[model samples]
Target chain A: MNLSWMAWTQPTAIFFIVIFCLLITMSIWEKISPGGGPRVGILRFETTRGDRLFLSLLGSAFIHLAWLLFAGSNLWWAMGVSILYAGFVFSFV
Target chain B: MNNKPFDNKAWFFVLPVFILVAISAVIPLMTVVNYSVQDSFGNNQFFWAGTEWFTEVLNSDRFRDSLVRNLTFSAIILCIEIPLGIAVALAMPRKGIWVSVCLVLMALPLLIPWNVVGTIWLIFGRADIGLLGFTLAKMGIVFNYGQSWLQAWIIIILMDVWHWTSLVVLLCYSGLVAIPEAYYQAARIDGASRWKVFRYIQLPKMQRVLLIAILLRFMDSFMIYTEPFVLTGGGPGNTTTFLSIDLVKTAIGQFDLGPAAAMSLIYFLIVLLLSWVFYTVMTNYGMDAPEKREVES
Candidate 1:
C-alpha cells in the first residue's frame, strides 16, 4: 500500500496527536489511582467520575447546538451559555 | 434511588440546570410557536397567518420528503450505532490500564465540534486531496461525494457513525462496568455460555443505559444539522436534505419565517412524541416490576 498521498494537515495531525497523548495520560492516571466509585449527587442518580465528565460534555454540546439554532453564530454568547451549563452539570449532574 | 428522604432544599441545587435548559429550550420554543402563527414580510411588519403556513408546509412535497429522509437517517444511525457500540463495549477490557486508554480514544471523535467533523470528512473524501478518495480512484472506482447522491449519503452516514458510535460505547461500557462481580461469578458457576450470560445477565443490566443511549442518539440524529450541512449542504439534488436542513433553508435561506416556524414546531413535536414513546416502552417493561416490588417492601 502506497502511503505517499496522505494529507497530514496541521490541525488534523494535532487533533490525533493530542488524542493519543490523552489516552496515554489517562491510562497512567488510572493505573496510579484505581477507583472511580459511584457517588450519589443532587441529581438523585449515582454517577462515577466518568459519568460526570460525560454529562458535562453532553450538556455543553446541547448548549452550543441550541445557541446556534436560536441565537445565531455569536460564539461568545454560546461560550457563555456553555460555561453556565458546565457549572450546573459539575455542581448537580 | 427514589427512596431518599424528602428534602425541599435540594431544589436549590437543581435550579440552575432547570433554568439553563429552560432558557435554551423553552424560550426559543415559544418564539417558534409565536412565529408559526404570524406572517412577517420585512420591516418588522406582521399579520396573523392563522395556520396558513402550517397548511402550506403540511401540503408541501419538499417538507414531507425531507421529514421522511430525516426519519430514515435516524433509523439507520440507531440500527448501526447501538449494536456496534455494544459490541465494542463488550470487547473492551473490563479491567486494568487498557480500559482508560480505550475510553479516551473512543471519546476523541465525539469531542470535536460537529462542523469540524464534517470538514474533516469533506477533506478526507475529496478525490484530489484525500487519501481515501485518491485510493479509491486509483482502484478504478468512481467515488465523488460532491456529485453523486448515493456517495454523499454514504459519506454522511459513515461520518455520523464515526462521530456518535462512541457515545453508545461509552454508556454501555459504564453500565457493563457497574455490573457486580457476583452476578458474573454466578453465571460462570452455572456453566452458562457467553451468549447465555450476555442474554440473561449483561443485557438486562444494560437496559436502562441502553434506553438512555437510544433516546439521546434519536434526538441528536433527528436534530442533526451541522455535520451534514457542512458536508453535503443537503445536496447532490436534495438527497441528503434532512428536516433541519430543509427548515433552515426555508427560514434563513429563503427568509420564510412563518412556514419555517410551522415546520420547526412540527419537527419538534415529532421528536418529542417519539422520544416519549421510546422512554415509556423501554422503562415500563421488565424494569418497572423490581421498582414496584421495592415500593411494596
Candidate 2:
C-alpha cells in the first residue's frame, strides 16, 4: 500500500480535471449568454475601467483588513464587521 | 423572477460584499488549488505531483464514504426543513408587535457563530447533565450520542434543523408577506378554502424563495463542520464523519495536503454542480408557470 502510486496520485489528477471542466463551462456559459448571469455585485466594483476596478479592490481589501484589526482574532466578528461595513458602503455610496 | 429591471448602480452597492466573499472564498480556494498539485515534505518544499493526488482521492474509500454521508445528510435536511419552514411561516402572524418579536427570536440562532452553535449543542446533548439527554433517559429512551451512531446522527440532524429551520421560515415568511392582499381578497370572494388559497396562491409565490432556501441549506449542510465536530468529534468511529470533517482531519490533522486539497476541490465541485442544478430547475419551472407566461406576454 505504501509503494502504490494510486494512493495520492489518482485523486490529484481528478481534482484538477474537475477544476478545468468548471472553468471551461463557466467560459462557455459567459460566451453563450453574455449578461444573462448574475454579476459580482458587491465584490465587483461597478466600473469597467481599470483604475476604478483597482481602487475598489484595494479599498475593499483595506476595509477587510481594518475590520480584522478592530474585531480581534474571531473570524465571525471579522465577518460581521466586514458585512456591516459593506452595508454601510452600499448605503452611503 | 421579479423582472423589476434594477439599475446597474446597484452593482456598485454590492461591490463590497463580492470583495469580502472573494477574500474568504476565492483566496482560500486558490491556496487549496495550489496545494492540490504539489507534493510537500513539511518545510515549504514542493514538487509537481501532477494528477496523482486527484486520482488517489477519487479512488479512496474514505472520500467516497464521506461524499455519500454528506449527500445523504443534505437530502435529509432539505426534505425536513422546506415543508416544516413553510408550515411555520404560515402559522406566523401577518401583523402585530408579536411578529417583530418572533422574527427577532427566530433570527437569534442564525446570528450565533457556527462554533458557538456547536458548543451549545455539545453541552445540550451531553448524556449526563444536558436537558435533552436527561429527559430522554428519564423517559427510558437511553439516548447517548457519544456511544451510539444512530443517536449521534439523530441529535446532529435535530440540532441543525433547530438552528437553521428559522432561516427557511424567515425566507418563506418574506415570500409570504410579499404576496399582495388583493390575491387573498379575491380568493376569499371566490370562497376558496384556506388550503386551496395556500396551495394556489401562497405556494406558487414561495417557489423562488424556497429554491433559494433549499440551495442555501443544502450547501451549508454539505459543508457543515463545526457543530457536529464539536458535538460528536466524528466519534464512535467514522460513522458520523461527514466530508468536511474527513477533509479537515486529512488536511490539518494528518497533514496529508495533497489528499485534503483534492478532497476540498471535489467537495467544492459537488456543491457548485448541485447549486447549478437547483438554479436551473427553479428558473425553468418559473419560466414555465402559466401566470408568469401571461405576465411576460
Candidate whose lDDT is highest:
1
User: Mind giving the per-residue lDDT tens digits that candidate 2 earns over B1-297?
Assistant: 445565669789999998999789865776677787777878666677755676678768888888898889999989999999999999999999989998998899999998898888887876688888778888888887888999888988998999999999999998888787888899999999999998999998888778788888988998899989988889779988999899989988999897788778777766655665565565555435546524633
Give per-residue CA lDDT, model 2, range A2-37, as digits (tens).
322223344545745765685586557645555434
Model 1 deviation from native, Cα RMSD in Å? 17.6
TM per candidate comes to 0.67, 0.68
Candidate 2 regions with alpha-carbon error over 4 angstroms: A1-93, B1-31, B275-297
lDDT of 2 at B129: 83
Q: Give candidate 1 misplaced runs (Cα > 4 Å).
A: A1-93, B1-28, B278-297
lDDT at residue A17 of model 1 (Cα atoms): 68
Model 2, docking class: incorrect
Model 2 CA lDDT for position B209: 79
What are the iRMS values of all candidates? 17.6, 15.2
Which ten contiguous residues of candidate 1 chain B have the minimum total lDDT? B288-297
User: Residue A93: error of model 1 in Å?
Assistant: 31
C-alpha lDDT (0 to 100) for residue B186 of candidate 1 = 89
